[model samples]
Target: MLRRTLAAVAAAALAFVAPVQAQAPAAAPVEIQFWHGLPQPLGGLLEKIVSDFNASQARYKVVPTFRGSYAETMVGAVAAFRSSSAPHIVQMFEVGTGTMMAAGRAIRPVHELLASTGVNIDFADYLPPVRGYYQAADGRQMSMPFNSSTAVMFYNKDMFQRAGLDPNAPPKTWAEVEAAARKLKEAGIACPMTTSWPAWIQVEQTLAIHNQPLATQANGFRGMNAEMRLGGALMVRHMQNLVEWQRQGLFRYGGRDSAADGLFPSGECAMAFASSGLRARVMREARFQWGTAMLPYYNDVAGAPRNSIIGGASFWVMNKGPNAGETGGRSAAEWRGVAEFFRYIASPEVDAKWHQDTGYVPVRRASYELTRRAGYYAANPGADVAIESLLRGGAATDNSRGIRLGGYVEIRTIIQEEMEKAFQAGQSAQQAMQAADTRANAVLRNFERQNARAAQ
Candidate 1:
């Protein structure tokens, strides 16, 4: 009787312990790495978002690493990928879309990953123009659009008032801009006009605003077989105007992007052409009252004043490693996470806050409407310029959507160098543009041939 009682008690204890062991949670968290170019405040913002995501979930955790600027981050990712140690996602600039897409089997399409995981993400809800560049010809999204921005004019209200120009009415055409520059210069303003991202603000904006193509085949939308078209009459005329303005003491050509930004925020320049995304930085740095305006257009050009192109970056997902799973495979759970993240980021409230903070256009129509209904535009008077610039009912021509060329970042550098020669040196505008066109074509052709072979 004693042995039976002891055995029964022991079996009961064993059963209780087995149930507790079976209900215990698993060890270790799934780590997902993200590499981005945002620094300081923006970087902090990203970390906060990731932290929130982690705290809201139990299975996966996101780790964000700042890998320097966009170019540096891309180079680092390429090197890391070769060693099979890249982050799950890398943020690349808008100009890098062609290169990233041509990177062969290295990247996985965002759509494919989401569909495989049974996550329902509506691509149509995203703003068409903002997401268009990252989409395939058939309209499949390849990357996640983040920090999309367009070029705009920045002017000092006090300077305009002092120059006897209406502070509320900014220049609407290229001719008016020149007149204002002359007025500001005559009024003894030290630097009447300057610009940042010369290639982007001056050349790219100039091309788009004038409704002219930057390359053959509608700015490379057709394919890699396209050639540079920067030597056209419109381009030459614009360069000549800038060169002439420099000679007339109405415009100052700052060194490059950083130098130009310094000129504007330091109160040395009364007017500038810069990215709309610079609003936050300028608002923080500028001591004077300032406002933004739509980029000016040439009067003679037919269908002029088309939408400006984007200058920021997007996120691309890598297609290898545990996250990517086997060939043609992505783990259902991982895909679900990616899709959820995208949907969360694209939510109306999230996009509105991002746009309000970063000065980037809200990537959803409802976000814009929500902001307007909330009187964001009324509180911030000139804020609608960027939205109007983008959504104004212009036909979706290839030129207006912006360039889609490989090795375009290097090509932009070449353009800057050649334009500097024309504007700073004594080289004729025609000569400078011709040389730039020749050099840029070489890059385009080289990329075309290389990518063609890879495709085959």
Candidate 2:
């Protein structure tokens, strides 16, 4: 009787535990690290996308790490490559193209990487302006365009009304912009205007919009031997104009970086020049009525207001198995996982959502059409201004296609530093451009020497 009672109790306990054992989750999938520069809400959006992708498949999990700013992230990735501890992917700003392209052993081009994994993604589906920027000279894509943006003008509608300007009619040309700025100043607006990425917005992009070149050698697309032409007549004149505006209180010098992005939303500046990607920030932070318009161009300059160049970042797959351990390459599973994640990103639905969430120019044609059909543009006036501006400019030229130069981040810094001297009255606009070009050329020359030797 004792034996029977003991056996029965043990059997009952076993039954109770069996169900729990059966319900235990399996080991998690392999994780692929993705290093990026997005912070806060943008980071949250990326994480959600990763989570969604992970849930849709059981093969891989993406681990996203927030590195510092765009420049910092690129530097860190390069360092990681040297140590053989780089992530599976890195988000590189548009300016990093030349460096990334020259990093011959540091990355596997997206087209080649996906092909290696037997995933034949259609490269033609990508929006031309966005894709063309990352493509190689031979027509192969070098990286994936993730979040491409262009310069746009943002103005406060209420402030326009207060300043007695047409709230419905933002300035279409730089001449009109100057007149409007004067009115805003007369209205007692604290800061009439400011700009983000002064060098990019005021120099390279501005040059391109006017159908002018910033550099020789096809803006560094052909080879490493390139030189800045920004010291030319047009650029000097533009800088002189800015100097005058500053004197008249029509333009406020917004720092070296994107600090001006905050001025417009804070209701301090009546107008600001910022990235189209800034719409997400403005939507969240601004409490007053605001509107976006085409980037103001000089009406007197022929071919003015050409398609603006991209400003945001792209996805670059870090070289797999840089150390290569015992294996000759990364595990096939890892390659497969990377390809799958990329496909998820390329999906039209995903791209459309990205366009709607952030005012970035859609990188896919299908994505743009989908977003339009879904009534996103109908509900959000002026949201598609970036797209329209991109289409307005017929085709990209050697000057306008995009800049591909080594040490571009440093070059931008040089331009900014020299421009600051002009603001302080230490130099004239002509002197600033001359100094900037000199400094920028030195950086480009150093890059040319390094890469030239490496090639040999």
Candidate 3:
């Protein structure tokens, strides 16, 4: 009789403990997939930032995955979509804007996603040059600008002084750049100047700076029927100048993509035209005093000093399932998690930290203002050059607006290939550009045909 009484008391105590346990909250985390293109050294930094975000709150967790280069990462994202495993966020290069915008059903526009949660992001709050490229004709941002950057002139201060040029007074015009390069060459420097992304910096950016057309139909902003305007008289003159520079030994080709990122920082070249993102790499690699300046432009050309174009990448939200919440019209648990994460990233504190840590321009106006108030620019001279150049015109025009041509990435390849023959002295600038135009037109026409079908 005593044993039965003891068992009943134990059962009552167990039942009481179970109710308390059931009343407590669950600590389970919502997972969101994030894929990017930064390799090794920089990838570690990305991982750290993502980790910090994940640890900041209990609402969501972001899984950071290094996909590959921008082009490769984009391909990977598309493949994932096909396989029904699309990432919550994918980093796409600026040139891919047209292609992504064309992929109608694949992505949920950022503005739309955020609006579902009753939050509206002001387009005016973004830097004009950075936002213009990603905006639709109806004036809405298609994706979130993560790492927007512009082309800038990076130079070795030591080499500048050694070449008898004032390190503080960087060349402001293409003529001045040529003069400085001549002096550096005369100083017995083997490689006076080199450039990364020759097509991007020398051709595309130069066109924009001169307020020239890259293609018809507003550089493919209007419609898919745009054709190449890169073979115009202005382009011909620019190419002729480049070919002359090559022949004069004043300019050296430093390969493509980020291959020549090392050339300037290593002190092998006095100057380079590369993306503003190279600032971080130069700081880590350069043994000499280095500085940045606005990209040199042609003084003779009308409207020659317009704002430069933006490079770098942004986070594009994939549809068909990024969040796990039940799907329909209302915001699901997954979308709320995604929006929360975006707010974390777009916050001024986070944006400023990212700008300081990397060389990329902060996309948000508030972030830029915050960074300026922190005296980051005053302390670090030349850092604000990109910002100043980007804000030059107050607003972007058809000529100064960024390139959005379909097949832009492929056209870039054709440009580089044809320009190679000119650099090697095997063909004239006119001939090289003509051939490139023919090849580029083919690509553009093909893109038109493909997208026309998609639109239909």
Candidate 4:
């Protein structure tokens, strides 16, 4: 009888233990590393998106690392790739598109990556300009468009009123811009006008807006033999005007890149030609009323004010593997996780939220429609200026589409250097234009040579 009792107790213990063994803890979610180049509030907003995504899903946790400026981030990503420790995604500026496209075995086209995981993204949902900028020659998307922006005029309405200019009317032409600058200067405004990304605003976007060519072969889209066309009559005239304005204190040369972005918000400069993305910063930091308008043009050039091209960065997926441009040894599940994360962000609700928060043009048309329906544009006047500027002209011509040339980052540096020399009276505007053309062409030729070597 005692033996039977002991056997019954053993059977109960075994049943309890079996249930406990069957209920092992779930596996931890996969972690994805994303590197980007955005400062301050923008970076904080991006993290919020990632955090919300993590909370919604149990499969992946995305960790974003701010990798300094665009140039620094690109350099770091390249080094990471060489060391076989690259992050899954990197935010590369639009100018680096050519370089990223040429990086064999280093990048995995997002379309292909998603399709491999049974997820097909409809590129049609994205805006044409935003879509076209990142597409391959074969119509395949090379990367995911994020934070796309264009140049615009940001002016302080209070200053405009004080300067005796029409506060409701912003400058519409280069002549008008100059005239307004003079008024602002006369009104005791020390820094009447300044520009961020001088090369982009004064050169690339200027060429596109005026329907001028920056390079031959349809702005380098046709082939790699495209040469610089920087010394045109219009460019020379515009550069000369900038130099004259600087001399008269109508315009101030506020350093390079985005270093001059603060001048407007800090109330130091009354007017600024800067990225539309500056809307977010200006809104948060500006103490006075501000307004945004389309970039000014010369009006004499045929098809002038065509459209401005995108200036912000895109998300590039890196493939760091030993194979020849194959997968990065990531498991199928992991790729699915990445695809899922992308799908979540690309949804209309999430995308619209990002656009509204960051001052970037919505990549997806659906997102724009959603934001409009939600009364975002009505509540915030001038928020749609970027979109309107991009769609000002009918269809984007070759001149207004975008620039795709290797070593463009270096070329921009060269242009800025030459322009600085002109502003300081070290060289004439005409001479600066000629020097930039010559030096930029050399950089292109060197890029071609490097590409040839890599292919062989």
lDDT of 1 by residue, 1-456 (tens): 787566556655654553344335673445677899988888787677778777876666678899999999999998877766777778999989889877766787888777765666666766666877787766788889877888888999989999999999999998999999989988999789888898888888788877788998778766778889889999999999889998888888887755687776777899888888778888889999898999888878888877777778888888553222243223334445566666667778877888887788887788899999999999998887887887654545677777788999989899889988887666998998999999988998889888897544
lDDT per residue for candidate 2 within 1-456, as digits (tens), equals 787567556655654554354345674566788999988778788778888998997758888899988888988998887877788889999999998988776788888887777887677877666887898877788998888898889999999999999999999988999999999999999898999999888997788788788899888888889888888888999999999899878999999778678999999999999988888888889989999998888889877768777888999988643453322134555656778899998899988897887677888888989999999889999899988776667777777878889999999999999989999889999999999999999999999888875543
Residue-pair clashes, model 1? 0
TM-scores, all models, native as reference: 0.91, 0.90, 0.90, 0.90
Local distance difference test, each candidate:
0.80, 0.84, 0.82, 0.86
Worst 10 residues of 2 by lDDT: 320-329
For residue 44, model 2's alpha carbon misses the true position, in angstroms, by: 1.1
Which residue window of length 10 is worst by lDDT in model 3? 322-331
lDDT of 4 by residue, 32-70 (tens): 889999988888988888899999977677889999999
Best by lDDT: 4
How displaced is residue 413 in candidate 4, in Å? Answer: 0.8
Worst 10 residues of 4 by lDDT: 321-330
**True lDDT of residue 42, candidate 3:** 65
lDDT tens per residue, model 3, 1-456: 677566556655654554344335674566788999988776787788888888997666789999989899999998888766788889899889998888766787888888976655566788888888888766788888878889999998898998999999999998899999999999888887888998888888888888899888888888888888878898999899888987889988888777788898888999999988888888888999988999988888876788988998888888753232223212255566677778778888888888888878888889989999999998988788888888875677886778878888998999999888889889999999899888999988888888876554
- Distance from true location, Cα of 393 in model 3, Å: 2.7
**For each candidate, C-alpha RMSD in Å?**
8.6, 10.1, 8.9, 9.4
